[model samples]
Target: METNRQDFLKKFNEAFATSDVDFILTAVSDDILWTIAGDKVIQGKDQFASSLHEMASPEPMKLKIRHLITHGKEAAVEGTMTTPNGKTYSFCDIYTFNGFKDAQIKEMKSYVVEEH
Candidate 1:
């Protein structure tokens, strides 16, 4: 369980660093459910992938993980993302997972804890 959480966090952190929809989708389940702080919900892998592709940017971005905690099939993560324009946002993310032999993200909820 511990190793799984660490691996998942690594993948998730990787997802935020690039605008590659395919690489980002690799960490999620086919029926992924994602909700943003703005109350927008993206359902299913196809829809999620499409949304990401549409929002892709050529600018650089960086993600720094502050902390990650997991228990059973759930986890909470804290991090900061620095955008190309030099804006920064600190976020808290909650994730739910359920899989046959290993945990895969089935749902994710994101909240902006701070911004600058």
Candidate 2:
């Protein structure tokens, strides 16, 4: 069960690099809340989808997952994303799921930093 959840989270993060909005939306609940630290707070699946569209880039990002940790209905993934232009950003996202079995993300808090 833990392994499956970990795999799901890995795919979920990879979807961001590929800009797979449909998969992203499908992984979350209707009332999903996302807080991007120092940026903006997104509420609901609709708003989340809108934000993703607004931030879509022509070039796909290269993502490296450094660590993935999960406990109960919570999880955290830390990684670095490198843009096509050579810009790299380190990020950590903490997630809360709706439940333990067949969980869907209920809330997410992300912290991102650009490496100088």
Candidate 3:
């Protein structure tokens, strides 16, 4: 199915809610730039996939989307989640999408606040 920015956000969130690595990977560009806050930044699909693989297990992280907004080819998603280690984190991700109909993510900047 062809996806616009909103559709991309929905699919991405749904995949994330279930911690579906394969499905989530399908929504990212091969050269995607993923930034965690202003500190950690990585490029390339392999690097991102590798990190996700390390995180997901039989019981994966839980994510629940509270809000999502999109304009043009950009989107911002905000949510709360529980990590595998049982830590709670509230997050917001700003995304820029490729012009393709499937709206693969070209760049993502994340901001997260965790309960210590």
Candidate 4:
């Protein structure tokens, strides 16, 4: 079960760079709340989907995950994403799952900083 959750989180984080909206949505709950630190907060699947589309780029970003930690119903992922234009951003996302088994992300808080 631990390994399963870890694999799930890996794919979920990678979905962001791949623009795989459907996969992301499926991994989250219907009433999911996403807070992008210093940016904006998104609630519900509809808003989440809209935000995903708005942030989607023509060329997929490259993601390099540094760490992934999970315990109980909480998880955190740290990574750097490099855009097609050569810009890189370091990000750490904290997540809360709906349950321990067959979990779906119910809340997420993201802290992202652009690399100079």
Candidate 5:
């Protein structure tokens, strides 16, 4: 029996494998809130889906998860991504998933930057 935190982290990684809006929708809550540094907060799953779609537009994005940490309903991920231009960016993201009972992600906040 995997904990909600573990499950969420696993599913999040799976999202990078394909642009499956359904998966994204299922993993997140109806009133999900998502944020990335310097970006406006995305208010719902619908909006999140639309935004993620653009990432896989010309080609699928690749993500490699380096580490994941979970403290109760909160979790964090450190990973590396390859941009469309072949630039690799290593990022560390901290996330909080509410509604542990539902095992659904109520909110997600991300902090990212170029690898240096």
Candidate 6:
């Protein structure tokens, strides 16, 4: 059986891959704080969906997950998102999940890094 965090991350990735805003919100807390690269911060599910739509608009040439690690209440993921324009953005994202109940994520804090 997968851990709650692992399950959440898997579902989150699936939602992202398909641009499913509703599914994303189901896994994310209502007050989740999502910080993207380049100083963009999104709060709440609505804002997350909007920001994600804008970010995902570039078209998925490819999105690859390089690594994922979890420690206590925190997790980090490294990945590359290649846009339709042929721009590859390598990123590392750190996340903190507050709690889990019924396998649902209660809160989260995300930090992002972009490759130079």
- Those runs of model 1 whose alpha carbons end farther than 4 Å from true positions after fitting are none
TM-scores, one per candidate: 0.85, 0.95, 0.84, 0.96, 0.79, 0.72
Residue 56 in candidate 1 has what lDDT? 72
Task: Give the number of the best model, judged by TM-score.
Answer: 4
lDDT of 3 by residue, 3-114 (tens): 3666668778767756799988988999999999856887999999997776565675677888888877888999988867788889899999887466689999999898
Candidate 4 has a TM-score of: 0.96
Model 3 Cα RMSD, Å?
Answer: 2.9
Q: Which pairs of residues collide in candidate 5?
A: none
In TM-score terms, candidate 2 sits at 0.95
Model 6 earns a TM-score of 0.72
- Report residue 28 deviation for candidate 1 (angstroms): 1.3
Instruction: List the lowest-lDDT window of 10 residues for candidate 1.
Output: 1-10
lDDT (CA) per prediction: 0.80, 0.94, 0.82, 0.95, 0.73, 0.65
lDDT, candidate 5, equals 0.73
**Candidate 6 lDDT, 11-74, residue by residue in tens:** 6765665667677767666777876556867887778767877756534346688777777767
Rank by lDDT, highest first. Answer: 4, 2, 3, 1, 5, 6
Residue-level lDDT of model 1, residues 5-111, one tens digit each, is 77767676666667767767887899999999786899999999987887676875788888888777888888888888887879888988875346678999999
State which candidate, 4 or 6, has the greater TM-score: 4
Candidate 4 Cα outliers beyond 4 Å, as residue runs: none
- For residues 4-115, write the lDDT of model 2, one tens digit per residue: 8899999999889888888899999999999999999999999999998987767889999999999999999999999888999999999999999998999999999999
